[model samples]
Target: MLKNLEYLKSGNEKQRRAFKVINQLNMMEDLKIYSPILCGTIPLSIDTASSDLDIIMEVHDFSGFGDKINFLYGPFPQFKLKRKIIRSKLIVKANFIYDNFEFELFGQAQPVTQQYAYLHMVIEKYLLDTNPSWRCEIIALKERGFKTEQAFCHMLELTGDPYEALINYGLRKQII
Candidate 1:
């Protein structure tokens, strides 16, 4: 029932709605859902009216999984599909805007940085586990249009890659 993610259940109405969708999606046994780790402001429990859902999912087959999502969302009224180079490797990301939230899909074959970002979600979860005060700071940054990773870096006063900062956090805390 996605019980461990207590933040989502306690968030605002929009977050609850997003959680419903994610929970439903999580039940799809045919697909490799990968926990649907909530990213962005949603997981931080600081969802503003402008907040949108950011779910990072790992799938076995990108095309097949995307086709299923496209069929369900009906081609995403406003959608974008693109490729970005990360860590010297090209990774494709498909974004869909549904109910004013952004849903992003990343395949398992993505680059190192892309994979690291997903892994960062886990690290963020653990960090928030002990102290959630950073939620307020992150939400404010997100409202100003800073990306989730950027917000993490800025709030933590960490330099370089946000993923690396999180990795260091995990190392220091011995949570990895």
Candidate 2:
């Protein structure tokens, strides 16, 4: 399912660069790396020029990965990074910024197949195959300040946590 990611290597220069950086990160033998799941507007094909790169990593190890990554990328010629624990999940994440483009690493202590990132990818594939029109609505909703997952729920009039909203939507729509 993720093999289609190879096409992203042909995306614009920035996307290509992001892909390269992600590949480099994946090469770290010590890290329990999962396939880099691309999220945000890029995969939906609704991204604006300013959209940044968002990649999800589901892994089994993160004991000291944050500090290690910080040390390795601290001197990124173009990016400055900040690491923090997401308040809800308490998962450590590192956000990297360079001018208007950004790259984020979300470390999930779960199998990639069991991660929400996998579900989002599934939703994306389902929407792409069966409801491409939703992509436009997503872009419109995003223009109104909703994130991608939020836009998915808002477009379907579902509420609450975006993850739960996705499940509810899948159930209600009989698409799960």
| Top of the candidates by TM-score | 2
**Structural similarity to truth (TM-score) of each candidate:** 0.69, 0.73
The superposed Cα distance between candidate 2 and the true structure at residue 147, in angstroms, equals 1.1
* Model 2 lDDT at residue 128: 61
lDDT of each: 0.62, 0.64
Looking at model 1, residue 98 earns an lDDT score of 63
Q: How close is candidate 1 to the true structure, as a TM-score?
A: 0.69
Give every collision pair in model 2.
Answer: none
Candidate 1 deviant stretches above 4 angstroms: 1-10, 22-30, 33-36, 110-114
Best by lDDT: 2
Clashes of 2: 0
